[model samples]
Target: MRIATYNVNGVNGRLPVLLRWLAETRPDIVCLQELKAPSEKFPAQAIADAGYEAIWHGQKSWNGVAILSRVGTPVETRRGLPDDPDPSQSRYLEAAVAGVLVGGLYLPNGNPRPGPKFDYKLAWFDAFIAHAAELLASGAPVILAGDYNVMPTELDVYKPERWTDDALFAPEVRARYASLRAQGWTDALRHLHPGETIYTFFDYFRNAYARNAGLRIDHLLLSPALAGRLTGAGVDREARGWDKTSDHAPTWIELSEQAPRTRSASGSRPSRAAKPA
Candidate 1:
């Protein structure tokens, strides 16, 4: 199976771009971030017309997330992280698509660091880490994919010196990311293309894309069960070149046919033929 993650920027304004990509790539499952649309305006019909079933958590003019399954409707798992009794933003969404538990998130950018925004980002990361620990203990095949907004290492950024003061490249942020991965979640792209300068997002400024100056903040983290099935992983750099596209590109991973079974909520094994829904 092929699963991909993309930050749409704005679902409505970029519907055509998204549809075109779906037509060209046809990923079995896709995790989308930055919908920037309210729940009622998610364009579900347009997505269905493109031959995908989706579940989304949306907010007006800001953060949002969704999971699209080309084969079936993804079963809703959760809407937000557990500890947040009242999350005002739509940043995380989880669902079961083709037996894999997919957690799609749009982590905070935490710009202009050393302030409340930066503190909030760190707090949210802590909540995510706590929930991730629970998922790890469950032993279910899981994937945490999306724009993490943190460049985990110098290797993930271009001209590391230039971003020394940027929140995305902050040492504290990177450390938290490392702490999460240290829990056994494999960073898929890095696992497949170690030490390579693979990038998935480029700033619209400075002609970043044309200059190939980008960052690999977008990531796919696989649980131990799915990590073993990883056969290939890469960024769809061409997608970033498309007109009216999001600054981010689609990053995907492929799995072998002998993928291990995922434990379902009821403690039962999910079937291979159990198409998405």
Candidate 2:
């Protein structure tokens, strides 16, 4: 079974690219971030026509997320983070698909630090950490996949020194990501190919893809229950060069066929998140 995550940037504007990738790769399940469309605007019919079932939480022209499954109905378990510091942005979604509990998130791209946006990012991280701990304790097979936004280590960034002060590479954000790792969640790509120079995102500017200058911000972290089954992981780097494609290509993990079929822990609801309050 293969599971993938993508930061599509814009669902409507990139539908063709999205459909093409879906057709070509045919991952068993897909978690999509940056839908940038409201709930009513989600192209449900089109997605269904592509042989998948979807559940999404969307916000107008901003953060949004969804889960697509071809292997089973994506029975939604949660959507918004409980007590999210900002419940107005559509940043998180969770569901039980093909026997795995999947949590898809689009962490904030807090650009400049020492400001409100940066503070909000940290707060959101805190909430996510708390929620993740609960998920960990559930003892169910789980895969938390999406564009986490923050590049956790020097290995994850093209040039570490150049990103020192950027919110995505700042010490605080990296530490939060480390916390996730310490909690026993395995970063699938790095775990499988430990010294490899792998990247999931290339800048739309400066010929980044051509130069192989990119960031590995998109991830598929497996909970302890699902870690051992991970067999392969990779970035569809060539997709970044496709026309009208997102800066992010699909990042995925392949699991052994003997996956456990279990339900997910619940209680969060789906809602469009707004600006940080």
Model 1 misplaced stretches (Cα beyond 4 Å): 260-277
lDDT tens digits, residues 1-277, model 2? 8899999999999999999999988989999999999999999999999999999999999989999999989999998998799998889999998889999999999977879999999999999999999999999999999999988889888888999889999999999999988998999877766666778888989988888888889988999888877767777777788998999989888787664353211211112111111
Worst 10-residue lDDT window for candidate 1 reads 268-277
For every candidate in turn, the CA RMSD to the true structure comes to 7.0, 8.2
TM-score of each: 0.92, 0.92
- How well does candidate 2 match the true structure in TM-score terms? 0.92
Provide the lowest-lDDT 10-residue window in model 2: 268-277
How far off is residue 216 in model 2, in Å?
A: 0.6
